[model samples]
Target chain A: MTQQHKHIISMLVEDEPGVMTRISGLFARRGFNIDTITVGKTQTPKVSKIVITVKGDDRTVEQIEKQVNKLVDVFKTIEMKDDESVTRELCLVKVSLSNEKAKTDIMHYAQVYKAPIVDITPKSAIIQLVGKPQKNDAFLELMKPYGIKDISRTGTTAIQRGGNGEK
Target chain B: MKGSEAIVKTLIGSGVHTTFGFPGGAVIPLFDEFLRFEGKIKNILVRHEQGAAHAADGYARASGKPGICIATSGPGATNLVTGIMTAYMDSSPIIAFGGQVSMSLIGNDAFQEADMMGITLPITKHSFQIKKANDVVPTILKAFRISAEGRPGPVYIDLPKDCQVGEVTKEAPKKVDIPSFKPVYRGNINQIKKAADMILAAERPVVIAGGGTIIANAAKEVTVLMDTFMIPTATTIMGKGIIPEDHPLAIGQVGMHGRKAANYAVINADLVMAVGCRFSDRITGNTSSYAEKAKVIHIDIDAAEIGKNIEVDVPIVGDSKSVLSDLIVVMNEKLKKKTETEWSKRMKELNQLCRCNMDSKKEPIEPKKLLFELNRILKTDDIVVTGVGQHQMFATHFIDRMKPRTFITSGGAGTMGFGLPAAMGAKVAVPDTNVFDIDGDGSFLMNIQELATLKEENIKVIPVVFNNSYLGMVRQWLEIYYSKRYSQVKLGRHSDFVKIAEAFGLGGIRVEKPAKIQDALKESIRSKETMVLDVYVEPESNILPMLPPGGHLKEAFGGCMNAKGVFF
Candidate 1:
């Protein structure tokens, strides 16, 4: 049987207009679904680091790498194994407070998860959390009772573990 | 200097002399620039954007350059989707331009606005949206380079009205600086040696030449290898004219509707050397058993296609000519002469045994006889373009295309209405050569209005419509797959192509019997002005040696009987 597993891929791409569209379009056209994605400025101003998590069989993953490399703006691509990578996701949620008891409960959950309450009001409270994707999901699920107004989650960004693991 | 001027200058810089386009509001400034440098670059004004796209594709395929086309926003840009996809599927290098809505009105649903860059992203090798006038020259140079570089395909540039009209003080750039794109051209010496070793050892070997052989201009290299090793070959639809089909060792096409000898040669072979060919499902029926007996040697420029479909024993990722040239050099020293003498003799015997009888004397005219005469009447260099159907398969089967870029067809997309316009485009590219569109009755009606373009432009192209009164290919499927219940396949004798051609102020003729087929073809050829011969043929005759659905090439069917000795 073929092995289907989640792969963490990173790329240094040209920070130009339509670069995102070109990269995303390649995956979409080939039917590779992106589980999570994050884009950020790299050490070099003109290059951006794009981290993408996707699920595919071994052959499909290999083809995905080749297809992604075919794009002109993409400089280099590195595949990071799930066990040998540093991964994190950040989420911010604005929840409505019905009473003082609700604020106390929200703070208790935040402390347990090492999340910080960024803002507070008589009718609402804003809490910020950072962890793995599953941790953020747990925080959001626990915040449901406090009447969550809105939630914003940054997709997981991954990096190779340890020194000299760069490609 | 205006941005549009920069764009035109870049076109001239890239050695482009001809382009096809239709002007609209968004591209007015670019059109003005085209007119300003009118003599330097020739732009053919087409009736529709799709025509421009297809004509440019034909010109590109004929002349070995990236074909160019321009269209306006919204409907104009959308209309080119078919042509763009056709080029994409067949791996043709075509540089297309779409005039987008201004930067301010990109997503505001402004008049004549369309997301061309987004729509064409999947179809193009690279797509760029020009935000600044200064970037026009660089973008165009990149577009030209990217389109023709590795695994050649269409590239698009979405030039907004604002960018076209914007002014740039600096001159157009001379060199492109896209650091990320580098195409691999040379094959590894070790892999070359391994392939040469296999070629030297194999007793029964057949070579499968594909479209990439033509794109890489590697016909001479392939021919050298064939002559030196005595390997018989079969081609796909797009690879028809890569090498002369009349060569003694050629077994014609392979796969569905392919020559029976070609399929037999491959299925019975011990080694299959596929050069620059993607073993698509259309070519390799039942991928699991496509080449079960052969240890495959696959050479292509695209690494993605190496083992994408059929499994390969040796996968070499490089240009076709380079790899084949390297193989030839190594084989000369590593191998003995006349290695495939017995295999080659058997190939010839099988070819003669399975050759379809094309000399039928039946009434209402058989397709094989007509295609054979058409093949005999045309010049070796005269180009043949085709739309999709049984006629397409017949043309590929019978016509002996002796020159590269002489047989143009929509092989990948199987698009109808590609024949006439593509013929006109080829004629425009090479004025001295005669162009013929071997079109089917159903495929001909899709863009018959292009007859007006032919008459107005005085383009000397012959439209030989094989009027079988049905969608012959689809009807064949219905006959084989279903119980002969052909729905929507018959076109119940309503439209008169001869009268339609005359209405467009062109010459026309109708041939109903077998006796008139040759004379009708000759008459169309002799007349200088554009003409059409509405030749009616037998509706039941199907292309021979067709692979049944979900079957291997060994189990291919011919004349209602399976080549594997089974009758269905």
Candidate 2:
């Protein structure tokens, strides 16, 4: 356990009932503390893409890879480097703004981050942000002093850059 | 076909010739259907559910096939925990079934309903709860495959009452292809080549043969590695019979209470070849200091065990026999000659230093003497099962095995009552072979009721009870670790074991003197019914060559090191 760093593993799996449970159950059993995970149907009708981010050293990453590969539904698993992959996360934030000037300021910050205000009220506004995880982090940092009401985050999901490993 | 009928048919298809279990309400339907296929598959009724699990385990270990055991829901299922755990730890392939309540009444807490899968999850290699009758046969086939394939272990399946009460179409079972569970059988040639080079370079190379060797049937390959290199070999308790103990290169048991020569050789070795044996804490006490001087080449079927406990220089993950064969080929091709170093000659002498003289004819019969005499009667392939205690250690030190799978004991879990049922199961598996359960007085009583099972089943297993009047192993631990202030270790001399045997309708002999040991043993072995030989041993005598808890390899003290119970 040396050099702790976030590891992103993208997997291609057979999309079926209980397949998600098997994959997640495997990671859970290995004691691999998952930081984030996103699962959805892939372009192939029967296949699904599951991207999981975990913080661990090299050995833990290797162990997780071996264990995940052992799952029956998993067809392929590959470790994704930050530079080699395009990662994204979506966050919906509801901000509390009492006055018109506060609302204008919150909208100004949201616009700077290119986040769209999807819902609004005199007391609160819901700003939807989409980009890398860090972009959402920046938007939250900007909105903290504006009295934030609530937030829901879509965990970091990734796809390897270019046409490589698309199957 | 009814679900119960499908299960029986699937079991027959899977080559399950025997099953050990007890009948209960939840399993009544299955039992009724099971009786119809009686000659096709024999179900031995055990005294308790736990006994059934252990018997199944014992059968699996001895027969080299998956053993089956069935039990009712709730209590019956939970009872198999100890037995299933014992099998799990020892890598025995056993498929256990737990009858569940109807699928509708599962959560209603109806009569005899239990979450069998949840209880057995941690202990089993895998657990399944079948929901539909159509899935019963496929699930059964998968259970068999999972239990016997790769690194064998127990697999539990919960059969709901509803699934067993239905009529469904009979169809061919699907192929078992859990791709993720693929076991690596062939060794990586590059790694094998690297390991061969490491072995060739070392002056003092010691091969530690573990249970994996037996599990993979790799003794012939292990011997090839040992004999070709003249490398001194040591065996874990579980690996006792990898080769005949009398073989020149064999260094007997290694670890706490293991052979002194073996402990010395390992500590002094330049290179260690750990084959199929996990360097368990008991095998490698104070892991840091153990084999610290050696460059280790660890070979095993399990990838997780490679560097889990001890760091290895070269880790080869594959079946032991396959790896050993690949290693032997690589070594034979690369090496010009068998490198006979002076270290080889020293190993032979060191091996002799570990040998103990058990000729003492003291008042109370010595367990060592009993083991020595017993060894004489036990032929090459005779099976010996022992309950966990000082008797187990003594058996490890003295019981000689010329063949594999002949020595059975609860190695991983060290469950006390494993001996009787295990030996019973082993005898049942190989009916013609003489199976003996060498147990301590304290350990024997743990499952003494199994005597009735043996008597009624007509299973011939000689139970040699080492009546020391105390939990001998715990007492020894007290002596070494607690300044001999023995607490809760003694079992006072009140019970008569032979009389108990007679009550069970089995004959028994009580031997108090050393000369009568042979007479008692022969008489018990020749008895028409299941017999017990209560051989009284000196209570104070402790098993020697014990490495203290967290002690270094060469730091072992007690008997075997010197003639008069000398401590080093």
**Considering every candidate listed, which one attains the maximal DockQ?**
1
The digit string of per-residue lDDT tens for model 2 on B346-446 reads 77766766676776688798899899789778877789999998999999998888777999999989999999999989998888888999999988998
Off by over 4 Å in 1: A91-152, A162-167, B559-568
> What is candidate 1's DockQ?
0.67
- Ten-residue stretch with the least lDDT total in model 2 chain B: B559-568
Q: What is the DockQ of each candidate?
A: 0.67, 0.31
Over the stretch B1-568, how does candidate 1's per-residue lDDT look in tens digits? 8889888988998998878888999999998988789789977878788888888888878877899989998898888888998899999889999998889998999999988888888888788899989889888999988899889999988999999999977766677878889888888889989998897788888999999998988889778777768888888888888877777778878888777778877887899999989998789989888878889999999988888887789999999988998888898887646654888987876665555556767878888888878877889889999988899988888788977788999998998888877787888888899889999989888878778877887888988999988999999889888889998898887368999999999999998887888898889998989889998888888787688876888777664222334222
Q: Which stretches of candidate 2 lie over 4 Å from their true place?
A: A9-32, A37-52, A67-77, A98-101, A131-135, A163-167, B336-339, B563-568
Candidate 1, B27: how far from true, in Å?
1.8
TM-score of each: 0.92, 0.93
CA error at residue A62 for candidate 2, angstroms: 2.8
